[model samples]
Target: MPLSSPVPRALRHTRAIEVEAFARDDGLWDLDARITDVKVRDVTLASGVRTGGTYLHNLHLRITINRELTIVDAEAASDAVPYPGYCDTIAPAYKKLIGLSLMKGFRLGVKERLSGVLGCTHLSELAQILPTAAIQAYANDVIQTRDGAGHDPLPDKPFQIDKCHALRAEGPAVAVYYPRWVAKAVPG
Candidate 1:
């Protein structure tokens, strides 16, 4: 979305991040995330002044996991980058996420495993997409579990109002899985 202003303007910088989730035929999941940073107008960066439309960052990441949401494989690549040498070398560190689960505290685990010299900050950010993507990839199972066709989806933890307000203990969404927590409240 472009910001609106009374002042005249020209395209400057555009940073786009896209994350996609895929359900594999064998009951696994695949996540692909790409980040593209473009200079829409001449701008000076640490490297040098870049021409408009030049890509400052073209990074790609892929993660594969099982139904349990435990990472099975992970890979990252930098096709275009603002810096050299260091950024391209972090590919090896992403493997450390292979057994990590797509669950609460997953982001902190990713940061701990890949922060500083071990990982590129951007790639580390991409690791956070796994938990949400797992929801998309397993929507059927989630709904079935909530409907009592499978195990309880919420586990022992009560509905959280802070994490996702729609699923709050005070909202109607609780009726779907934790009917005991349902009450009157704005869904959003």
Candidate 2:
């Protein structure tokens, strides 16, 4: 369903975040993400004046992970920014993500290593989405998360069974699509 029409409003600013996943020939996966912020009207900043339709901030981040979802390499770049020298210098700090697993406490690990002064606010925020983006990218292609099958020793439930409202083990969607994981009624 689409959102209903609302009172007329003028455009002010736009922020776009894009994430793309690619499978490397070497059996790894690359998740590339970019964030761009644009203002509809000219804005003055501490640095200088940014003209209308120009990018206020444009940043890029990429992480390479193996089938296990462990990041083997990470990098970030700031093509356009409010503070050029300062903002772009923080790109190297993202390397600390190399050893982290996207599926295991990735957000917390990112916070511990790159929060506040240690990292760029925008890049850090962009890193937060990689985990789910990777999952969505690898859904059935690199990893089989759907039917609860294909593993040497299958888990009691699929990884996505209770992760969302539509997939809740006790929900109707689960009863129809993932019947094997439907929650059993408790004996009263």
Candidate 3:
């Protein structure tokens, strides 16, 4: 077992979310997200129940997507939770994520599919982070293959030349990757 960190005080509880990227032999990437809510000291629930060193919410979510970031598979499990029955209530609906692509409008899609009464709040929150992590995990190979080099694990796609100050068409990256869109020098 690894050595534990120093103990904390006044820390009634902790909410830890961990996301891990994994490579599979079948050419798909797997992203695992785990959420844990732990209380350091004994606490009383609103129902007059007392518990300590217990998990308020322990959720594990797995998402498998291909190079194009289309969801190939998804599964979720609740090992423990403050209310176990409520935990599984919204899990089944996450399967709707299949065939959905992770792109610019993906966040809204997540909201539509797994928000409010449609899905588990904690699980939905964790699933929201998978798209970015999946892009980082799966796109490195694609970028390297197509560009002949990995450019920060992502290729320049959309900037519209005026999205932000640093990303202006005159920015260094745009000047190199999208020279045609670069802002021309002004004559004094």
Off by over 4 Å in 3: 1-9, 46-50, 145-188
Model 1, TM vs. native: 0.75
lDDT per residue for candidate 2 within 1-188, as digits (tens), equals 99999899999999999999999999999999999999999999999999999999899999999999999999999999998788889999999999999988999999999999999999999999999999999987976676533434335566778888889888988887667778987888
Clashes of each: 0, 0, 0
* lDDT of candidate 3 over 1-188, digit per residue (tens): 98888777476778999988888899888889999988887777753443677787889898888877888888888887666566666666888788788765777888998898888888888988887677566543643312212333225544234656765866886676655556787998
Looking at model 3, the pairs that clash are none
Model 1: residue 58 alpha-carbon error in angstroms: 0.9
Q: Pick the candidate with the highest TM-score.
A: 2
* Candidate lDDT (C-alpha), each: 0.75, 0.90, 0.74
| Ten-residue stretch with the least lDDT total in model 1 | 142-151
Score candidate 3 by TM-score against the native. 0.72
Model 1 residue 127 distance off true place after TM-score fit, in angstroms: 1.5
Model 1 misplaced stretches (Cα beyond 4 Å): 1-10, 141-163, 173-188
Question: Tens digits of per-residue lDDT for model 1 on 1-188?
Answer: 87676687677789888888887798777888888899877777687787789888889989988877788998889987877675677787888888888875788889889987778888888777768767765765542334322555455444243258777666566666666556656677
lDDT of 2 at 94: 97
Better of 1 and 2 by TM-score: 2
CA shift at 175, candidate 1, in angstroms?
5.3
